[model samples]
Target chain A: MRIIRYSEAINEALHQLLASNKKVFLIGQGVTSPWYVGTTTVGLIDRFGPHRVFDTPVSENAVTGLGVGAALTGMRPIVVHPRMDFMYYAMDQIANQAANWHYMFGGQMSVPITIWGIINRGGEQGAQHSQALQAIFAHIPGLKVVMPSTPYDVKGLLVASVEDDNPVIFIDDRWLYNYEGDVPEELYSIKIGKGIVRRKGKDVTIVATSYMVYKAIEAGKDLEKEGVDVEIIDLRTVKPMDKQLLYNSVKKTKRLVIADASWKTCGIGAEISATIAESKLLTTLKAPIIRITLPDAPAPASSVLEQAYYPESKDIVLAVENLLKYSCDNNEKCDY
Target chain B: MYKKKSVNTDIPLKTLREMYLTMLRIRKFEETVASLILKKEIQTPCHLYIGQEAIATGVCTSLRKSDYVFSTHRSHGHYIAKGGDLKKLMAELYCRETGCSYGRGGSMHIADPDIGLPGSSAIVAGTIPLAVGVAYSFFLQKKDNVSVAFFGDGAVGEGVFYESLNLAALKKLPVLFVCENNLFSTHMPISACLANIDIKKTAETFCIPTARVDGNDVQSVYKTAKKMIENARKNKGPAFIECMTYRWYGHVGPNLDIDKGLRSKEELDYWMKRDPIKKLERQMIQQKILTIAKKKVIEEMIKKEIDEAIAFKNKSHSPEKIDIARSVFKEE
Candidate 1:
């Protein structure tokens, strides 16, 4: 294993794919410029040549559809949408064409296209640039939505997505880019619809995704010091969720708290909450589930307001503490 | 001004007959669809390719079976001309299990990647970028395959059209953008939509080579498409062809759309004078290469094919419920 930042891990994965496969190519607005896509696409053009690593114009919809077209014609294309929020411009291609092309053509064709969308949260980026629109993508039936938090999973999931025989939406949050983690030097893949337990305990279950996984881990540390053990499940893939892992974890700890970066209403948190509720765990619930998410509104631009807009470790801690407090109160009063 | 090519004496007679037969087949297939819809044999909304058959036939004839074509909602002509299975296309419109898309994509999303027609879409200006991508793939592979995007004049108003043109030119990819300028966008005429209606000018502004031809004249469309496609395969970059044409049927369904007061009968009659099939027949007769008996024989053969396709569609079954869950991904 090699220690690397999340961005470098992704860069290594792409570099490996380009070097190993002649059929693979990269297309995006600033694939050659590190300033736009950062170190993730650095030195790609220099290594693989121009025909493979192409820097394109600011035509998101067309570029995305171009990626789909290339993928359809026996090419593995990793098309980058530098900002996840702006990807809505290319939603028609992503949702309608890329997602539905295989199914629409009776499964005779497959789009081996990996659409990489980066989530830029905070930085005074305002409403347009800061959205984590994973829910919008997850809602689409034909799309496979994956959100990788760690440096290792970032490389693994991206490779898995590229190898998958369908159009996969690989979403990454930039807030997790600079963070360091131990990633493998050899090429490997983590399955698309799997999750892992970051820190396991029995007091309460904390299911978090994307960058929110880091915040939930921090919250788990705080609770650990407070004698309340918190279990953290880093949900790597949002769409084909690891339901069995989550259900079994929830079965062990009846109290649940979900942390997500998207809107509170109709978000992944709500989906998880609903999934747990519909399962056999509903009868064993000690208290109502809590969700730590952004307020249901556009992100404010002000630094202070932005602080309030995004949920942090304190918010996760508070949600978990509140759920524990309610359960503890019920146990103390013998209110079974 | 676009220079019109004269009837070159160099081309083979068999090729000319094949192109003529393709246009007639499109006409007959659409006519069969019209009667099927009228008789309630098929239920999905269909945008026919009656008068505009020449453009599709001409453009597709210029392409190799290895080349790709991404088409619009009015795609029956494109599907047939590009060598898509007539039986599968008819079954698709009928929403049967044996359909090309297995009833998932009614008339709009017909596709046959085996024959280089990857797919078509109902959304206006949808497949334009897909074509550019296909061309980009050829550029990456360093191959000679050309990709074509066929859309109506109304689709030119879409932002994607300009974006696709810009990218295709900037990259100098092997792509051909064919805008069938049928003079109308649903109910509104093109004049009402765009302040300046020079369709080729926008593409030319992007430094891409542009051509405007009489869409109803099969020879003119065929000549321009072949040249541009050849230029694209030689890595001369992308080219845009604007074909002046008309849709005989309404924007959708079996009836004529002119009764909605969007267009006058006089305009329709004027365009009908430039009928592509008649123009091809006149040329063939003038050259004394094809007699009326031969033309009738060709028409009869096409009718039999259309009749067999309709029968196949009628006999096929609807997909079972489990099939719906299957095609969502490859793993299924």
Candidate 2:
């Protein structure tokens, strides 16, 4: 195992895919520019030549349609969106065309394309430049969304997405780029819709996605010093979520807190909370479910405002402490 | 001004007969669909290719079986011309299990990738960039295959149209953009939409070779499409051909728009006098290629085909309730 940054893991995965398969090619606005896509696309153009690693003009919708079109003709294409916010311009091609092609055609055709959308938040990028809009793509039926947090999962999930015989939305956060983790050099894939327990405990169950997984782990350590045990589950894939795993963890802990780097309403947290509510697990919960997410407003640019706008590990600790306080104050029997 | 090509003594008699047969099939199939819509047999909205048969027949004739053709909401003519199964298309319109799309796609969404017609969509300019992508695939593979995008004049208003053109030109990919300029975008005239109604000139701005032809004249459209498609197959970049035609029916169903006051009767008559099928029939007869008896025999053959397709549609079953969620994702 080699310790590699999250962005390097992604770059290595693309390199292996292109080398292994001649049908795989990369296309987007700034694939050649590291400043736009980070080091994830580094050295791709030099190794594969220009035909395979194509840097396209700034035509988001057309470029996306180009990917879908090539997929129709049996080419595996990876179309990258430098910023997740501007991907809305390609909504018709993504939602109406790529999402519905397989189903509408009665499974006669398979669109084996990967849409790589990088989430850029903070750095005072403002609302348009900074967004984690996985919820929007996750809402569509035919699309499969995966948000890998660690370096290991990032490389594995990307390979799985490219090989899968459907359009997979691979979302990543720029904040997680520099973080390093152990990744196998060999090409392998982690099963989608599977979650892993980052840190195991029995007090409170924390379900975090993508970048928030690290924050949740940080909070878990801080809570450990205060004698509050926290269990963190890294939800690798969001669409076909591992409901069984979540149910078992929540059943053990009897307390649940969902941390996602998106807005609160109709977000991934809401989906998970609603799923638990509908399941038999509703009876297993000891307190109301809490969600740590961005407030219901656009992200601001000011440094002070940015500090308050985004949630951190401290917020998770506070939420867990508040839940424990409510449990002890209201009930005669307190597990904590 | 677009130069009009004269009737060449070069086209084979058999090819002329085949083009005539294709146009008649489209006209008769749409006419049958009009009656079917009135009879409440087809429940989905259909954009009929009534008077615009020549463009599809002419362009498709120039293409090989391996060449890809992406079409628009008005797609029956393109499908039939590209050798899509008539019974399957009819079954799809009726939303039957044995349909081409297994009842999932109606008139607006039809596909047959086996014959290089990957798919068609209702969204204007939806499949334009897709054709360019397919062309790019061929270019990357060093193949001589060409991809054609058949859209209406309304699609020219979309930004992706120019974007696709620019990409095709930038890559020098082999693609043909066929614009069936039928003079109306739904109920509005092209004049109301485009400040500059020159569709070919718009494509020319991308440095692509452009051609304008009379869509009612099958010979003109065929000659132009063949030249452009041949040029594309040589990997000489993309070409655009704007075929001037008109639709007899309304934007969607069977009813003519004349009663709705969307178009004047005088304008409709002017195009009606230039009916592609009638014009081809006249040319074929004057050339002693089609006698009245032969024409009657051909008409009966097409009528029987449409009848058999309708019967197949009536006999097929609807998709089962248990399989409602099937095919949403390709089962691995």
Candidate 3:
């Protein structure tokens, strides 16, 4: 195993996908430009040529529909929107066409398109450019949403999305691109709706999505030094969530803190919290669940406003400590 | 305006008869659909194809069975013309499990991929880009097949329509864009909707070959569509045909809209005089290729087919509640 950047892992997955299947082609705006989609699409045009690496015009709706159509015709196409916020232009094709085609037309056809969207935050980008819309896509029934935080998961998830016989929304965060992890050379696919236990503990359970997984781990380490045990779960797929994993973890810890990289109102955290509240594990909770997420407002342009806008590992740490404090106050068996 | 090229005497009488048969089939099918809707037997909101049969019949008659066709909301004619199974389409309108879409999609989303029609979208201009992508796949696979997208003037307002045209011409993909300019987007007239009335000129701006024809005349539509379809198959790039036609019913359902004051009866009568079926029926009669008695026999045969389709629908089962979530994704 070799340590590689998350972006490099994505590049390798594209290379393997193209080589393995002649029908697989990458189409989107600025696919040929290394700067446009970051290093993930580097040297793709040179290696695969312009045909397989189709750099399309700035037509989000049509390009996304083209991916759906190509998939219908038995070709695997990955349509990319460099910015996740701009996918709104293609919501008709994504939500109405690609997502509905399989179910609408019965099982007669399959639209195996991987709609890859990148989440860009910070850098003074205003509300329009900075967004994490995985929750909106996760709400759609026909689509499967995957957000991988680690380099290893990114490569495996991308491979799995391309190979799946359904539309998959692969949302990646640019903030986690520089993170390095050991990745295998051979191509592999991670299951779509499964989650991973990043770190094991006996205290509060922290359920995190995408880049928040890294933040959760950071919070876990800090909590450990402060004499509070913490368990972190990386929710790789947003939709079709690993509810069993979360339920089992919560059943043991009897306390929960959800950290998500989106708005507070009806976000991934809300969904996870509701799931735990509805299940039989609701009886095991010693304290009320806490959600660490961005405030119910748009991302600000100023660096100072952005700091308060985005919830970090410290927010997770605070939520966990508060939960433990409450649990200890209510239950005599609690040890902090 | 391109001169009406005489229907080549060389195109065999059998092919010409088949063209007439397709148009007749569509007209009869839609007439029955309207009656069914009035009787409340068919619940789907069907966009009738009574007055626009020529374009679909003409274009589809020239297409191979393997050539793909993407259609819009008003698409019963396109499906029938493309050799779609009548029973499945009827079942779809009836919302039965035996439907083309397995009772999931109603009249607006009819599809038969087995006959090269992957699907039809209710959204304006939604299927345009899909057709272009299908053509691109054919080009990439070195297949000689061509894809046709049948949409109304309403789709031109959508941004994706031009995007599809740009990509199709840029790649020299094998596709035909058939604009059935029926002069209305729902209730708004095209004259009021479009800034420039020349739809063909828009295609010409993309540097794709363009043609405008009398859509009511099946021969003109068939001839122009044949030339364009052949050019696409030869890999000469995409082509556009603007078929000036009209829908007899209001935007949807069986309403003529005359009593509703949406459109004038005089206007309806004017277009009715140019009825595609009667125009083709007269031409065949004058050419001595068909007789009045023979035409009656053809009508009888079509009526029997429609009856059989209805019988099939009657026997078909409605979707069960247990299978409600099935086919949401491809099952492994």
Candidate 4:
């Protein structure tokens, strides 16, 4: 195992995929430049000539369409968008063309393409740059949405995304890029549509994604000190979400809290909460399904206001502590 | 009798006849589709390629099975000319299970990967950059296959089209940009919409070899397409062909007057005189290349084929609701 930052892990995964597969190439604006916003594609152009690592003009719609076209014709194109907000410009290509091509063509064609973007509420970037739109993409049926938090998870999930035959939106939180974790030096890939239990416990199930996974882990550590055991499930892929795993966990723990960095309205947290409510686990709840999410307003430009806009470890811990207190006070053999 | 130009005598009479037949097939198919729309049998908005058959047939003639082709709203002709199965295409139009897109993609979105026709988009100027990307793939693989993009004069106004053309020319990739200049985009005429109506001149601005042809003349379209295609195959870079054609029907559906009238009766009549299928039939008869009896036999054969296609489409099932979640992400 080697310690590396989240961005370096993605870079290593890309390097391995490119070195192994001759058909794999990179495309997008600033992808070939060392000053890539995420710094995930640094030194890629030097290793693999300019042809393999192309820098497209700032035509998001056209470039994304080009990536789809290339992928259909048997090239694995990794398109990098600097920020997730700019993806709206190419939504037609992503949602209409890339996602629907396979099903629309009756499985006659497959787009082995990956669209990577730096997401989450970055400091002082204002409303445009600092927003997590994973739920919006998750609403689309044809796309696979992956948001990996740790360096290990990023490396493994990215390698799998590149090799997969579908169009994947691999989201990287800008704030999590510098966060370091132990990653395997050998090439490996994590299975798509599977959630991992970061910390296994028996009392409550805390579901989180992207940067919120780390916050959940931190919250779980605090809960452990008070003898309130927590099971943390990191949902790497949000679209083909590991529904079975979530259901099984909810059934076991009976209580649930979702820590999502995105807004509350129709977010992935809402979907998970709904899924739990629809499942047999609804009878097993000890308290109402709790969600620690960002405010429904646009991210503020001020650093202090932006901090309040995003959910943090303290927010997640407080929500969990409240649930634990309610369970203890009502002690009727806690159904949830 | 019109004299047949033998610019490339090496191209066999049989090859020319085949090109003519392909164009006729598209023309007849569109006519049948139009009648179906008029009778209310087909429900979707149909963009008839009645007058622009030669452009599709001509460019598709030069493409191999390995080559990729992208098309636009006026795409039935391109799809059929590029070897798409008539039965599947009919099924798609009928919104049946046997459709190329399994009834999910209607009139404007028929795609058959087996024949190298990926798909067509309803959005104007959408397929230009896609074709360029496909060509770029061929360049990367060091393959001789060229990608063909079929669009209308309206596409020139789109920024993506200009960006794609610039990139294709800069990369010197194997691409054939076929502009079927039908003089109008929907109700607006090219002259009214564009500053420069000359598509070939616009292509020349990017240093791409440009050719202008009478789109009604199938032979002229075929000859120019062959030259441009050969040039691309030799890695001589991209070439642009502008076929000055006209759409017989209105922009959408069979009704000619459903929308606002843009073309005069005199203009329509003058263009009808140069009908591509009728012109080819006349040439074949005058030259004794195809006897009247033989022409009847060919018509009967095509009619039978179309009838069988309609029957197959009628028998095909509609898509299941459970299939909605499938194929979004490719399973390994």
Best by DockQ: 2
List A-chain TM-scores for all predictions: 0.97, 0.97, 0.97, 0.95
**Each prediction's TM-score against the native?**
0.97, 0.97, 0.97, 0.93
Candidate 3 DockQ category? medium
> Candidate 1: misplaced stretches above 4 Å?
A329-336, B1-9
lDDT, each prediction: 0.90, 0.91, 0.92, 0.85
DockQ winner between 3 and 4, please give it.
3
Q: What is candidate 3's lDDT per residue for A1-336, written digit by digit as tens?
A: 999999999999999999999999999988899789888999889999987899988889888988888899999999999998989999989999999999888778999999999998899998998999988998898999999999999999999999999999999999999999999999999999999999998999999999999999999999999998888999999988999999889988999999998988888989999999899988889898998888989999999999999888998888888888787675454333
lDDT for A127 (candidate 4): 94
Which pairs, if any, clash in model 2?
none
Query: Candidate 3's interface RMSD, please?
Result: 0.8
lDDT of 4 by residue, B1-332 (tens): 75554343445677777886788788778889999998999997789999888788878887898899998888899999999899998999998878988887889888988899998888888878788889888988888889998999999888778878887887798889988898887888889999988778988999889989999877788888888888888999999998998888888998665235577877888888888888877877776777888877877878887999899998899888888666655676
Poorest lDDT segment (10 consecutive residues) of candidate 4 chain B? B2-11
Every candidate's fraction of true contacts kept comes to 0.74, 0.76, 0.73, 0.57
Report lDDT (Cα) of residue B331, candidate 2: 73
A211: Cα error in model 1, Å = 1.3
Deviation from native of the Cα of residue B79 in model 4, angstroms: 1.5
Q: Score the docking of each candidate (DockQ).
A: 0.70, 0.80, 0.79, 0.61
Q: In model 2, what lDDT does residue B83 have?
A: 89
